[model samples]
Target chain A: MVPVLLISFIPLVRGIYIGFTDYELGGQISFSGLENYRIMLQDRFFWRSMGVGFLWTTVVTALQISLGLILALLLNQGLRWTSLYSVLMLVPWAMPPIVRGLMWRQIYSPDTGALNLILTQMGLIDAPINWLTSFEWAIPAIIVAGVWGEIPKAALFFLAGLKTIPGSLYEAAELDGASAFRQFRHITLPMMKPIMAAVVSLSFMWNFNAFGLIWILTQGGPGGLTRLPMLAAYEEAFRYGYVGYAAAIGNVMVIIISLFLFFYLRVQLKERTS
Target chain B: MQRLISWILYYKGFIIAGLLAVLIISVYIAGEMAIRLESDEIQTGPLRFLSLAWQEEAVAVVQEITQDWNQAHPEQQVELIQGTWNAVHDYLITGFETGDIPDIFHYESAVIVDFALRGYLADLAPYISDEMRDDILDVNWASVTRPTGAVMGIPFLAESSIILYNLDLINEAGVIAPTNEDPWTWDDLHIAAKKLTKDRDGDGVIDQWGTAMGLRNSANILMNQSIAFGGSFFYYDEQGDIEVRVSKPEKELIGNLARMLFVDKTMSPSGVGKSGAEMIPGFLAGNYAMVVGIGSWARQQVVENAAEGFNWAVMPPLKAVTQNMGVNTQTLSIPRSCKRTAIAMEFIQFLLSSENTTRLAASDWMLPTRQSSLEDPRLQADSTGWKVVTANAQFLSTGPWVGLPGYIEWKSRVANPIFQEFFSQRISLDEAAERIESESNSVLARYQVRGLKW
Candidate 1:
């Protein structure tokens, strides 16, 4: 407990304090309260990246949850080699984030990538499309990779939820002459609601703070189209030497994420109590 | 078999994780062992030199140089610590904050300037030997010298901007090959590119391009080579006034390059959002007759990776207003936190001696900063366009905006996006020029203010 408090709170408190000061390189910081915040308020890039962070989080989270639900339903059906299939599903999650980024970077390579190769071979494109570099396609391509990496964990959550739905409920519905689709609609969807909320909340925060996959994939390039808030803060602190400004950006992100989770969790609790 | 399989399956997760942990630990241990037998001990070396040279040839040469020093002076032994290009800045920042940056480190002059400005780098003006100072071109020395007259680092390796082209393609197009003495102007390049661009197999689509370049990361290229077109971009007057402009002279290279990309259709479209290094594969495949990149690419990429009989040659640095290419030398610096400044400087001087510097530069196919090293027979050869590569040395000048605080931010945040938009043809040329000027000025204004304080 002491170690945890020291590790977590020291940086946390230091970051919060730095956000109020005008800290930078050379260790010559003077406190200019709210000056960093004022700059952030007017900074167009910060707003643009914040908007992108939300768009990325919402899209990635929604898609992963839905895809996860589908995968969970399939796995819960107890198909042949069910255990093997479940283990095979861990491959995406098991790989390091950097490995995923590199793998996808190779897959998205314009000249020699597998994606472009398959697309050209399938006659989908007349020439190789620059997936990672093109302004039009870069964000969607990255989103696809993000969803692919996180879907396995989301599926595990839903799979656990699916297991607790009770075989008796399905049996009763079947005895009542309910169709497969009808039974799933009445039982699985309702039963999965709480787990869905938990998954959504967790995935939203995780995807919002994402840096590694996107940083490696794009470095927030093709004109800052893929620059998430983390990428922005990273540039501010490290690239631009604006440590205080970076901490301010981080503080803003945390506040935003917390506020979102606060209200979201409240709604979940309200429904559960009612 | 069944019992063994069951047992294995029961502990598979732990087994896999243990295997991964072992692999990582072993790789770390192997890297440590590869460096030295005593490297694992805390007293292995009193000094640590972080180097970013990753190429096997370059790494071997660097390791050999450091090992030689170690054998000679066991007391002041320097352990070579490996660093990567992508994360070096962040590592150095954290290291400096904790008062533990490398005793001696390798980085480009462009980047080391930031540290120097922040007072994180040691002043080397007092320690740099006169022979060493005179032997290196004054222009190379100018790159690492800040406005305060303090030399930040010793400039060592450099690569001038040059054009690499297929000789057969140039000959086939009936374009006279450009020599080091009489290089092509921007106009000459545009016209020749139009002539060389062809639709082989003639299916309405052009299969081959006259030239290709990855335009996405052209900020550094622009900063360096735009001087030839008389675009200093940032002009400093002796009166201590600064002017940042993006006018006709500044726009010439990008304008001609754009026309080649779109109007003439002589440049490859795939290079629109990529970098010159990324487009090298297409150049080697003979899909593009010419590739404009650093001189080192001709040596490293074309020499090492190209197919047999690729028939490639490099054009000397092109001339417009003049053939003055911007120089940003790869530098070795002593961090301010280091206790062994004198010893580190000596190690640096020894490491960058004429013989050692030449060998090191040759391994990486980069130019040595020292004039004596440039005269080395191995580097001064005519074969594989070495003559053409080294001939550009006379054109090297300290690039515009040298040692300017906030220059990195402007290049990355403002200039990169505007250039990417223009190259992708999403923005008009006038819009690009205007945005580059206005946005960069705002960024520089903040820097000017912060520079006074920090």
Candidate 2:
């Protein structure tokens, strides 16, 4: 356990140290002091990406968890073909991120894409929108792609938590004259609090670092509308060869996620005490 | 023993398998490296070159040259590894990082600027005999030479933009061909575009159009239009840093001309109901009368369509832009890490030799980089399409694109979006220009890569 943790921590430590230094891979490294971090503060793209990261996580996590919990609640009712729908819905989550990204790219393609073709025929739009190219549409388009691949996993997690919730509790609430919505609020919400916390945190972290779908669909384009911290970090490190600066971006992402986890924990603690 | 086995099993076979695979593969690679290193001591072996020539035909042409080199000099053979354009950077970067760069590799003009700035490419000034250097035409040399006074790469192949017009469509419109001696101006082109555009089926929608300009990746095309109206792109002063000198007239020219294509509806929309790659077919189908394309596509699509009795002609850019000028250069250079520099140089010299150049020109339509090969009789004897490519070779200019270290990235990242916004009518010309300047400046400031002044 110690060895495994230490091994992982080594890269983290090294990355932190490298972020402060002027490390250009295969080149010379000098002490750049706070230059990289200072630059990070001023970079509009970095801040824009941070904003994007926040929006992406909040929206995707909320949508997935809410949709997932609702679906799980209905499925928990022991409805017909519940197992079949659950199994079928799991396919997207089973797909690799790269495949999901590529599949979405084709679907969003402006020319002869299945989505546009169908939408045009259905008279939903007068013209095929450049979903991946329009600044107004690029972020939402990326979110849709991310959520399409993620909602399934959220469903499975909630479903798992659903199984743990004793059915007798719901029966007990019903006998007390609590309505259906009230029963859900009283029995299901309280019972699934810990599971919800887990799902939200996991989804937040995962969506915060989502790279493949954004990269494939928009590549941080339409004037940096879809740029994320990960994409920015990658461009800095690999494309521009600013190893330290890229590492700094990575470190910043850690701090951002840490804050999210902090707020999440605070909420959970309040829930527990109450 | 059970505990040890359990610990091993806990890893899911990843560690043991990974280490074993690495060891075996490293040993095989080491053995191959040992033989190659040993051979290098006795003789210069096959000089390997990496190039972005993914297509079979392109690779075959390169192979033909290497085979000839091998036959001529049995002592020193040549090998070429072909990779797609996207993978070329990865292969080169990995090689450079590991100190395993190829002897010779090809780079496009803009990328050469970045590679040269980072000191990855060899400064070829010390190389090549004075006479050999003198023989390379100045224009072709400009395509590879750094504006910062570094001769980084040898120009191997190049293409410049040409105005490809469907002659049949023009004649059908009762419009006489612009005299071959004196071509149409931008005003004339605009007028013709307005006329050529028609609702053929009376469906109240444009069917046949004057031009088909792809708005998605159309900076170079738009820049060329701007240049035709006497606009300037990138230029630097004696200080070797970029000097913002884009003229007001040029800015207006670019913005107004781009509007002619986008807002004015003379050209197809960015994805105008089809992909950018599909434009040629659309043009051939009489959907568009003209398109601004390079010699490569003009020959492949326009000229090839002639066999089906669809004749096409090339028109020079309008006045102020005396000739077709846009970014097009495929060059060869040795990386600094290359261990086989001498052999690579030999191969390059052999390639530039008149005989090989003639052979290459015979096989492909690439504009010859050598002065002696320019007058190669085989070029004249080739088909009308090839002859058009050859004749345009002289007046074809390449520049205004290779003025910065991060030039290609600037174009792809900064300028592409600005142009996209412009085409989409999402931003005004002034706003687009401001964004272009600031974004490009920000990138340059962030990277701190240096560029040279011409």
Candidate 3:
């Protein structure tokens, strides 16, 4: 337990200290205090990255959770090959994130992409769309790729929750003349509350720190439209050598994530008490 | 059931032992990866060297020369290892801290000053013989020399900045073509940019731009523009002090050129932060009239990607600066701690020889550093922009940036911010200069040591 806590806090402590100091790869280091934070606040890229991160998390979580719940309910029905379907649904989750990102990037490529080829062949569009290059379509294209990658894990959690429900409860509801929708509302959601809470919290954290997908896809470009916060941190630290500024950004991320977790826990506690 | 559970618990020891055995094997395998050591048996024999060049052709040329050298010497053999561009700096810095740097490695000309200041690089004045030094071009040697008056490495190549123009666009614009003797000035370049800017179908959108300067590495663009205006950006004064002549020039030359981003509107404001993606594809599609890039790009992109019917013209240096500035990205250096310094030095000489260096340049489309290599019949045989490239490489001036340890940080803290502030009209030139000077001095103060000159 001691080792676990120490390992957990090491990154936090390191990031905080590094944020307040000027760290160079081969040069000298000096304490800069809130100077790094001040510079970060003034940086337009940092703020732009924050906005992109929020949009990315929001869209990915919403789509993932909704699709997951729908898929879980469909699979929970006494459908044929339900076990095979559940196993097949996990393919995306099993595949590496970087590989998934690469495959999607190819599909969305401006020149000679499979998506455009299919669309043009079907006569859905006369000309191939420059999906990755165009400003209007790039983010949406990335979001589609992200949602595809996320739905599998969320579905697994919901499916686990679906299994824990007793068949007798549904039979009792049927005898009481409750409709299928009412049974789900009254029994299914209440029973799945704890699992849903856990899944949602995990999903929020996972999506917040999502780096590989964005890095592999757009590299935060077409003028930094798809730049996530982590990419901004990477550019500042490695490319620009603004270690202090990057640390400040990291600190800001921590504060934001902690606040999100606090609110999530508050809701969980209130629900438990009620 | 109780009996079966008891048996399972009794066999737990075997299970635990098996798991620990697997864990030990995995750890052993992982540990062995860090132990990838070449035989130390030959440490007293053959010399080992590493070349961190990304170009495959350059690597091949270096290998060919090493084989020939090893054949003649009979006892001395050399080893060359390749590293990625990103890894080169990190590996060197890490190596210096841990004392693991190779016998010789390619150091970018820009970062050579800092490495030398840190005492990570060996001074070539002792290793490089005078006759051997005389063979290298003077300006090329000057570019690699430290501010403290010591040569760090042999000049491998000269990569100068030149304007790559779309031939079809120039012909259609009805603008008088730039002759070899009378090259276009910054003013001429700007006028051409305006003529090239057009909304072909009158859609209130520019389908073609006159020019697009590299936004990511805009400092190079500013340096070239400053040279056009007869100003030096950063250089070592006679006293070995820093002189930022271009940043606060008499004409605000660098800032004036930066204003072209917004004032002239030749480059699109929409692609400011994201430059690499914008510049490469934009030029390839006939969307830009001209681009200011190095000789390597002229050979690789303009020549290779020239669409059928798309021919390119090579324009000479603009007049704001009389001296043409050439930027060399990577320079080779030998680490001081290496035991194979002698063999490494010999290999370095062999690598820089006219025949080998020419083959290296021809394969990679890189400009040859040697004066003798520039006149090679093979390079001159090409009717493409190779002739103009060689001419540009010959009379080029290559110092000004690359001399200070704080230059990289300054580009972000001082140069980029000044350009962004100027382009936005958020601050006056006076304020920008004062801020840049104060900040850069503080930055240099931290890096400056008694032995290290800033």
Task: Output the TM-score of candidate 3.
Answer: 0.73
Pairs clashing in candidate 2?
A: B148-B452
* Whole-model lDDT per candidate: 0.86, 0.71, 0.70
Candidate numbers sorted by TM-score from highest down:
1, 2, 3
Q: Residue A145 CA error for candidate 2 (Å)? A: 1.5
DockQ for all models, in order?
0.32, 0.20, 0.19
Pairs of colliding residues, candidate 3? B107-B331, B227-B321, B228-B320, B228-B321, B229-B320, B229-B321, B230-B320, B234-B400
Q: What is the lDDT of residue B188 in candidate 3?
A: 82
Candidate 1 residue-wise lDDT, B120-171, digit = tens: 9899988988889999998998998876678999999986777888888888
Model 3 residue B398 distance off true place after TM-score fit, in angstroms:
4.7
Residue B314 deviation, candidate 3, in Å?
1.5
- For candidate 3, the per-residue lDDT at A268 reads 80
Runs in model 3 deviating more than 4 A are: A1-67, A70-92, A100-148, A167-186, A204-211, A214-274, B1-56, B91-100, B194-209, B212-216, B230-287, B307-310, B321-323, B398-400, B412-454
Question: For candidate 2, lDDT tens digit of each residue in B134-217?
Answer: 766777788777655577787766655566678888988877656445777767877888878888989677888888755566
TM-score, each model?
Answer: 0.91, 0.85, 0.73
Candidate 1's C-alpha runs over 4 A off are A174-181, A263-274, B1-45, B237-239, B452-454
Q: Candidate 2's C-alpha lDDT?
A: 0.71
Q: Report how far residue B364 has shifted in candidate 2, in Å.
A: 6.6
Instruction: Put down candidate 3 lDDT per residue, A189-261, tens digits, no spaces.
Output: 9998877877777787788888888888776764467779988887676654556667878888888888778
Q: By DockQ, highest first, what's the ranking? A: 1, 2, 3
